[model samples]
Target: MISNIAELIADRIGTMPASERRAAQTLIANYPMIGLKTVAEFSAAAGVSSPTILRFVSRLGFQNYPEFQSSLQDELAAQLQSPATRTLNPPSPGGGTVSPMLEATLDNMRETFRHLSDKQLADIAARLADRRGKTFLIGGRFTDPLARYMAAHLAVIQPNVFHLAGQESMWRDRLIDMGKRDVLVIFDIRRYQNSLVRFAEKAHQRGVQIVLFTDQWLSPIARFARHVIAGRTAVPSAWDSSAALFVVAETLIGAVTRQLEAEGAKRIREMESLR
Candidate 1:
């Protein structure tokens, strides 16, 4: 499967020169929107010269700047697609076919992990395993299950793990308890939730360490995030698949469980005794 520009950037970021790396990081933070701008605009935003920006585009396998911008434009369109729009105008005659759905979902999973590095996972896991700070998980309408799933696992492993649910006001009220020692894990995908973006911004201002799980286009929350895992959620169906994000959540749970093996096992044993 062809990797998106975001995925390509992630794959090559480590190998890029300092100037190119800066451009790549800037693009990842702003995502397709920044790439959609003129080359001069992109160069200015990345704090790199126009030639360096062109080189960065070339390194990503685009033949020219316009081609790079076009790819980003296509991704932007895909990112904004609604379920109703997809259903009304399917990508293919057999867009509803089970095989195509499964294939696309599996590809999404493949492409998601392709960009994720071991160091990134280990660092995030280590932070989550720490009992010195609180961990709070929240998600948008479609992705909340990921927040709940991770929270349920982490709660057993340690204390002060919270799954933030309920109204927007409720989420805001909980912010009072958050601070520098706290970590906020937010799961948000495309047609990105404005409420979550606002919540993330507020938490950022309050000094909360944020880990964001979003789709390739990235949620606006990326600006506030300390760690971000951009999964591939698009598929052949009307609804975007959360399968890849679910897998990513499971991977984190496994990593945290391993890190907290003794504590987690003891907690599990104690809970079993209570039962």
Candidate 2:
């Protein structure tokens, strides 16, 4: 499936020519900041000529720069477009002291944090602390890195950690090895993939515990998840924000670390000694 714009850019970056790839890299690294800037400003920052940037946009299937910016800006407006915020519309069009996008980000965080609880954190931590079977982290096109990030820290402190590949063939290969004792963590966002939803459902039927991290719209797979962690919604943009989902990953890592306690500390020391 075609991913959101940000994910599309990231997916294509490796195959792009040197100049275009550099331009893509700069935006990925500093998205909202780079996204809001004029084409000239962004092109200059990427060290490419202005026209090159426009071509890059076209490569991503955008009709023009404003269309690109509007997609990016949508992520900012999406969350704050709640009835109250819209009805009580701010006096200015986000050009004053507070950037509307920034405000939306704060709102997203607040909502995400508010929904999180000690019990839920501890439950996920317990699942990670269990050593019987492998821990599998599965992230889709846009969220694969977050899954890998989760695998990285969990692997350091624990015995079995695996990052599941996102491709259909590779994903099924990985799923075949999973069983009742294993735990599966998935990260999925909007423009959902039906195949992935089916994968999650199959995993659930196998009795593997599922932990899901997703955006506000909620994945259809959430129903099958043993634990569902929802991210705050971002404003509408050519790309969407996983900022809230990212925090969820970090928090889970922290909780897992705490749960491991003395065992975790000992493992870290041994790992450090090997370096």
Candidate 3:
């Protein structure tokens, strides 16, 4: 059985027909929710025929529509799992004798990059490199460290990098200053936060382009995002892992730093002189 249906779709999406590709894109945007809908609803959302939807499912290696829906159902269940519930039934690949975290983390990184397109990475990096616009980063309860980490590197690489910390009220206060040229980088995973969603919605209204870093189950913030990186987060443990997302951040940090090499070097020297 395929461990992640989304990853399977990403791997096979290149060879899919145009109609089937639309179905795949639609499914990725809305995720398991659209897959759980009726065939007519799913097709309408994709702007494709019902047969095309079926063909897309088959390409994903499912026998029939119901089987495809069942897989999505299972994924949805796993996405909603709480830490308490996961501990009761942690995935044990080695019959509980050996830990599977290291292997899982490595696999997560491979699958994440395999699905991530070069064009998507480059487009986002270019946006961050543009010094005219401000960049703001935010995250959920557990993921905010990523926001701060990225913001720290970006602060040196370029100007106008802010990590939205503290309360939701504070985030909203900053929205008034945000406008079309600005970008919001959000890190939200499963059990997504409503406050962040609300903040993203407001940011989008002000014409701020969004970059979202989330798990396989795409966060609602994706609808407003200009770019979305759905990294693999699941592991054989009570809590979901952020290691893959961390690598993603580091990769972007390296990419953006390289893109702004000369300027970044001067900034580093200036920072040192100040110290």
lDDT, candidate 2, 1-275, per-residue tens:
43356668867888789999889988877865797899889998999998888988888888998998888778657635764554223434546444666677778888998999989888988987898888999887888899999899999999889988747878877778889999999999987778789889988988989999988789998999999998886764457878778877898899989888899999999999999
Off by over 4 Å in 1: 1-96
Q: Native-vs-model 1 lDDT?
A: 0.90
Model-by-model lDDT, in order? Answer: 0.90, 0.84, 0.90
Worst 10 residues of 1 by lDDT: 86-95
For 177-227, candidate 1 gives per-residue lDDT tens digits of: 999989999999988999999999999999999999999999999999999
**Candidate with the larger lDDT of 2 and 3:** 3
lDDT of 3 at 130: 89
Question: What C-alpha lDDT does candidate 2 achieve relative to the native structure?
Answer: 0.84
Models 1 onward score TM values of 0.65, 0.64, 0.65
The alpha-carbon lDDT assigned to residue 147 of candidate 3 equals 97
How many clashes would you count in candidate 1? 0
lDDT tens per residue, model 3, 1-275 = 43678768877999998999999999989976899999999999999999999888988888999999988888767767854554312455547533577778889999999998888888889999989999999999999999999999999879899999998898889999899999899999989999999999999999999999999999999999999999999888888998899999998998899999999999999999999
Native-to-model Cα distance after best TM-score fit, residue 140 in candidate 2, in Å: 1.4
How many pairs of residues collide in each model?
A: 0, 16, 0
Task: Give the root-mean-square deviation of each candidate in angstroms.
Answer: 20.2, 12.5, 19.9
Task: Mark the regions of model 2 whose C-alpha exceeds 4 Å error after superposition.
Answer: 1-98
